[model samples]
Target chain A: MSVTSLDPVRSELLAELQQKVERIQSGPTAEPVATHPALSGLLQLRAGGVYGVDAASAALLLAAGPSLAGAWCGIVGVQDLGVEAAQTYGLQLERTIVVPEPRERWLEVVAALADVVDLVLVRPPGPVRQGEAARLAARLRKRGAVLVAWGEWPRCDARLTVAGTRWEGLEQGHGRLKARRVRLEVRRGAAPPRERELWLPAADLAVRPVEAEQVRRVEAVPDPVRVVS
Target chain B: MSVSPPLRTMTVWCPDWPVMAALEELRPDAPVAVLENNVVLACSPAARVDGVRRGMRRRDAQARCPELVLAPSRPDADARAFDAVLEAVEELSPGVAPLRPGLCALRVPTRFYGGEAEAAAVIAERIVSLGVWDVRLGVADGLFAAEQAARRAAPQDVVVVPTGGSGDFLADLPVEVLDDPELVSLLRRLGLSSLGAFARLPQSDVHTRFGTHGALLHRLASGGDPHPISRRQPPPELVAALALEPPLSLVEPIAFSLRTTAERFVADLAGHGLVCTAVRIEADVDGVVSSSRRWAHPRWFGTADLVDRVRWQLTAQPAHGPVEAVRLVPEVVEPLGDHADALFGPGADEQVERGVARVQSLVGHDGVVAPSVQGGRGPASRRALVTWGERADGVRPAARPWPGQVPAPAPATVYREPFPALVVGAEDQVVGVDGRGGISCPPARFRAQQGDPWQRVAAWAGPWPVDEQWWDEAAARRVARFQVVGVDGSAWLMVVENGQWWTEARYD
Candidate 1:
C-alpha cells in the first residue's frame, strides 16, 4: 500500500534476486544443443571402424542428454546388437540396413536410410579409405545431422575415442565374494576424455564402481577329526 | 370315409434267420446269441436250441451255446442302414417309419399298389431283396395290429387285419407287443397276460400307474391311434477352410485374401439362390485358436460385410505371432429371392472392404470378427465373439460350478498370453516345518514389473487346494491357491505348494 517506501522484507528479496542475476551474468553459458534440419534424414558410415560403433553410447547421447522425447533415430549395422540396443532404449528404428556379400549394395542401403530416417547410426564394414569416409561424412552433414562415430573415422567434425582398462577388487554374489572390474578411457575432439574405473555387476546392462571385498578369495582347510583318536 | 381309399400297414419278418446261424462268425466254432437293449431281444435259433432262452444273460447264453457269437447292439447304425430298406419299401407306399432295426410300419393307399394283398406282396419282395434271410408280410388297418399279425404269420405268409377290425384282431396277441416290461409284469400279476384282458382294464387305473404313457398303452392295446409317418431330411453340408499362414503381424494381406475368397465363395453360391446369413472366421495361433465375431446380416451376402467380418476376425486374434493361418467360412445360408441384387452399390462394398482391410492391417487377422452362437450347457457356452469364419465350438461347459470365480461375467478382454510372474520370498523356508520337511504355508510376498513393493498380507482366503489329476498322471499339479491383498493396493491370485509359489493372476 505504501507507494514510495520499500518494506524491509521486499528490499531483502530484491537484494537476493540481484545477486542471483549478477551470478548468472558472470557464469559461463552452456552450449546450444544441435538440431537436425529435417524431420527424417539418414546417417551413413564408412566401412571398418563404423561397424564396431558403440550403439548404446550413441543412443544415450541422442536421447537421454538433451533431446529426450519424440527424437527419431536409426542405426545401420552389420551386426544386430546396435539396432537391438537402440530399440531397447525406445528409439523409433525403421530398419537395419545390411550390406550383403560382394558389398556393392552397401551404397543403396545407405541411400534408402538417408531418404527415410532423421538420424542414421551406422556401423561400417571394417576399415574404409579416407576419401570414402570423408564423402560419407559430407553427405551426412548435408543432411543436417551429426554422425557420432564410435571406432575410427577418417574425417569428421568431432571425434570421441574409448579405451578399456581392467578394474581390480569388487564385491560379488550376495556380497559374499570378490571380482575384478573394468575402467574406460573416453577421448573427445583431439583431447583425452575422462578415464573412469567402474565395476561391472552381474546384472544386465548395469555398471558400478568396484568395492573392496570383490577381489578376495576364500581358502579351503583340511578336516581335523582323526587326530583325537 | 367311403370315397377315400383304405390305408394298409405291413410288417416283414426274417424267415431263415441267418443271424441265428451267423453266431460262428463272431467266435470260432462257438454258438452265438443276439441281444437287443440288453434283453434277449433275439437269439440264434441255434442258441435257443442250446437252452439259452430269450431272457438269459450273455454269459449263460455263451455257456449254453458253448461257442457263442456275441455282437454289441448298435441301434443307431442299425437304424441308419435300415433306411435303405425303408427307401425301397417307400416305392410302394409313401408313408414308412422303421420302428426297429428289423421292423418297419408302412401306410400304403389301397389303389396305389393294386390292393392290400398286392401291396403286401410288393413290400415282402422288397424286404427279401434286402438280404434279410427271411420275410413275412402282414397288412392291417393300423400299424400295431399289422406288426403283431406279421409276427404271427408264417415265413412267407401275408396276414391282413380287416378294416375296422384291428381291435378284434389284436385281442388274442401276447402283452409283450406293448414293449413295456412293467406293464407286462403288472398284467402277469393281475392274471391278465393277454392283450384282450389288458384292454378290458378300466382306463383310469392304467392312467394312474403310467400317466399319459399308460393311456397311450391302452389305446395301442385297443388298436386305437393311427401311426403317423414322419420323414426327416438329410442334414446340410458344412464346408470350412484352415489357413496355412497365420496372419499374426499383418492384417491387410489376410483381410484382402479373406474378402476375395469370401466374394468368390458367395458368387459360387449364386446358382443355388442361397445367400449366407451367418459367417464365422476362425484365427488359429499355435495350438490355441480364437474365433471372430459372427456376422448375421439381413442383406444376405455382401463383399463389404464379408470383409468386415474378416477384419473383425483378424483384430480379435491374439497379439502373439504364432498364428499359422486364418479360415473364413459362412456357417448359415438362407435362400435369397430373385428381387435381391447380385451385388451392393459400387463403393459401398469397397468402402466396407477397405475399412476392414485397414483394421486387419492394424491388428492381426483374428482381430476382426462377428458375433456367433457357441454351444454349451453353461452360461459361458451360450454366446461368443468368434472370428467371421472360425468354428464357434470353443464353448466348453465349466468342469465345476465356480460361483465366485475371478471372471464373473467373464472378462471382455483377456491377454493373448499369460504374463510372466515374479515370486518374492518364494524360496524362503517356512518358520515351522512339517514332519515331512515341507513348508505348510506359501511365500508372503509377490511383485510384478514396475509394481508396488512387497506388502504384508492383510485379509486372505484359501490355499483352497487342488491336486493334479492322478489318473491322468501327465497333467497333475499340486497347487494351493490363495487370494491376497498387498500393501500397495494390489489383489493377486497366488498359488503355492510343492516347494514353489506363483502369481496366477492379478486384479489391477
Candidate 2:
C-alpha cells in the first residue's frame, strides 16, 4: 500500500518504529548526544551506557553539550551545585531538573527521569548493588537515555578521571587565581587509559585543548614562594 | 398595540450584599468598607453609623471611621455568594432573571400562590431559611419599577405596587436612583430633583439631548419602564462526584473508582467546548472535607492527567479516615480551540509531563524541581528551584551585577553547607585574618577537609574581604576567602570567618 493511503496516526507510528529498527541494525541501540568541542576526538556519549567521572565539574562538562543542543537534562543528588558554573559550562538551566535529596528513592527517580529526558546526571549516596545497577542499565537502553554518574557505578562503559592539575597567576600573597591546567585520563573497555593535557577551563571560562607554549609559560614560575617577611 | 406591555415582576434585593460578602473575612459586627479603585463601593451598617457612605474616597471614609477595616472589592465573590440565593428563589419560582449579584427578578406567581403578596412571602421565607436575613421583595409592572419597590420594602417584608400605579409610585423618588452618575448630576443641576420632574420633560426633547440611554431612563421614571427581563438559564451541572459506598482506604482503589468521574468531568467540559487547565480535587470522609488541593497544569488537562493528579494528592497526604466521596471541580478553563498543537497533534511536552508526574508521585509533591540561576554572591544563594511544572515567579533577577562574587570559572561542586577544614600557617598554627584584612601569617599547608591528609599549598591568593549585613548583628558576617591549589592539582575555595575556616566549594 502507498504511504499516502495510510491514516496519519498509523503512518506516524510506523515511521517511528522504522527509525528504531534501522538504529538497531546500525549496531548502536541509540544515537550519540552532542559532544563538546574539546572532547570531540576524546569522547562520544552514547545512549544506554553509564559514563563515570571522578569530579563534579567533569560531569557537568559531559552533560553540557547535549543540554546546549536543546535536550532536556536532569541532575540528581548533587546538593548545592554551583549554578553559575553550570551556566558557564553551557547547561541550559531553564530545561534542567534538580532532585537534590532523593534519599531512598535514588534508583526510582533516575529511572523515571530517564523515560523523559535525553540526559541525566546522578550522584548516588552510597554504593550500588550489582542487580539494581543492571536493572537501571536496562531501563536506560529501553528509553534511549544517557546516564552520567558522578560517583561509582558498576559496569560503566567508560570512565573519565582528572589525573593531574596546575594553577597559574598566583604568588605567595600578590596575584589571584587566574587559570587551571588538568591532565585528563580516559579509560574504556579492556583498553589502556589514554592521557591528554588540556585547559579544563581557561581564564575565559572556555574549555579547550591546551597548547605547548601555554604549558611552558605556566611552569616558568620557579618555586612555591614563602611570604617575604 | 405594537409595543407589548411589561410583565408583572418581583424583584428580590439584598441590601449591602458586597459588604456582607466582605464580612466573611472579618468579625461579624466590625465596621468594614469595601473599596474598588480607592473609592468605597459599599460599607457595613456598622460603618454607616459613623457616616461611611458609598463612593466616598478612601481617606475621607477613613477619616469618618478611624476603626474601619478595609476590604479589597471582589465582584466574583459577591456573585458566587448570590448564586445560592438565586438557586433558592429558583426552586420556588423558575425563570429568574439575575440583574446582578445581590438582586434578581422573576415573573410573579399570582394564581398558584393565591396572591402576589403570598408569592413574595413564600420566596422571602425560602431565602431567609438559607441564612440571608436581610432580604426584601417587591411586585410591580416592570423591571425598573419593581427593583425600586424592592429597595423601599422593609427587611423581610414585601412591597406590592398596585396595577398601573408604577408611574405615581416612582414620581416622588429622588433623581439619584437613575444608575448613571454623569446623567443624574446633569439632571440635578437642571433642578429636576425628583423622578416626577425628569419624567415631565417632553419625550422628544429627552431623546434629542440624552440619546437612547436618556430616553430609556425617562421611560422608567414615567411608570412605563419598557425594560423586560431575560431569565437566566441554570448553569450546567459540571461538578462530577463519586461516592465510595464502603469507604475504601487505599489510594489505588479510590483512584480506580474515580476514573469514571474524572472521564465524565473532562467529557462534560469538552461538551461545552472548554478544557480545564486547573482543577480542585476534594475528598471527604464521613461528610467532612479531609483533603483538598488545587492542581494546575502547564497545558490543558485530559482524563488520564486528572486521574494522576487525584492519585498523587491522595498518596501525598492520605485522609485521616477511609475516603467516602471524591469531587473534581474545574478552576480555570479555556476554549478548546486555543490548542496550539492542533496542527501537529500532541507534542513531546505532554509525554515529558507524564514522566515528571511519575517522579513527583514517587518522592512526594516537592520532590522534583526545575532549577535556574539567580543573583547572589554565594553559590548556594544563586540557585532557585521551583517545583517542576510550576511557573517560576518572584525569583531574584540574575542580570544584576553582584559585586564581590567569586570570579569566573566558578567551582563545580558547591557544598550545600560549608564543611569545617583546617588551614594552617607556618609551624602548623591556624590561619587568621584580622578585621582590616591583614593576614596574621601566610597559609603554608592545609587540609581541604578534616579527613583528607594535609598537603603543601602550591599556590594561594587573598584575604579578599567580604563584610555583609553589619547592621544586623545576628546576620552580620566578616569573612576572608582564598583560592588554594593542592600539590595534586585539586583546588578549593575556602573562607575564614572570625578565625574559623570552612571549605565552601571545589574546582575539579
The CA lDDT of each predicted structure is 0.50, 0.84
Instruction: List model 1 lDDT by residue over B1-508, tens digit each.
Output: 3686555566665532424334434542345555654556566555667887777776667677766565655445445556777788777666566676767776655677778787777777776777654567777777778878888887756888888788898888888888899878887887988888888878898899778888888888988754654544432444445465534556666677666566666776665676676677777666566555566553465778777777766676543664566655667665665225334432223223333333333344454443322332212233344443344334334455543333221111122223344443335433222334344454454443234344544334554445545564556555554555453333455555554455544432
lDDT score, candidate 1, position A169: 20
Query: Which residue runs of candidate 2 sit more than 4 Å off their true CA positions?
Result: A1-28, A212-229, B1-346, B390-394
What lDDT score goes with residue B442 in model 1? 45
Per-prediction fnat:
0.00, 0.70
Q: Which digits, one per residue and each the tens of the lDDT, describe model 2 over residues B1-508?
A: 5876546999999998989898877888899998988899999989999999999999999999999998877676688789999989989888998888999999998889999999999999999998888999999998888999999999999899998999999999999998889999999899999999999999999999999989999999999967778987655778889999999999999888888888899999999888887799999998999999998765678889988998999999899999999999887776776654544764455556656876787887678888888877766667688777765655679889988777767788788889999988878899888878888888888888876777788778888888777885667877888988866667888998878899998886
- What value does the lDDT take at residue A214 in candidate 2? 56
Interface RMSD of each: 20.8, 4.9
Best candidate according to DockQ: 2
**Candidate 2 clashing pairs, residues 3+ apart or interchain:** none
Task: Give the DockQ (2 decimals) of all models.
Answer: 0.01, 0.33
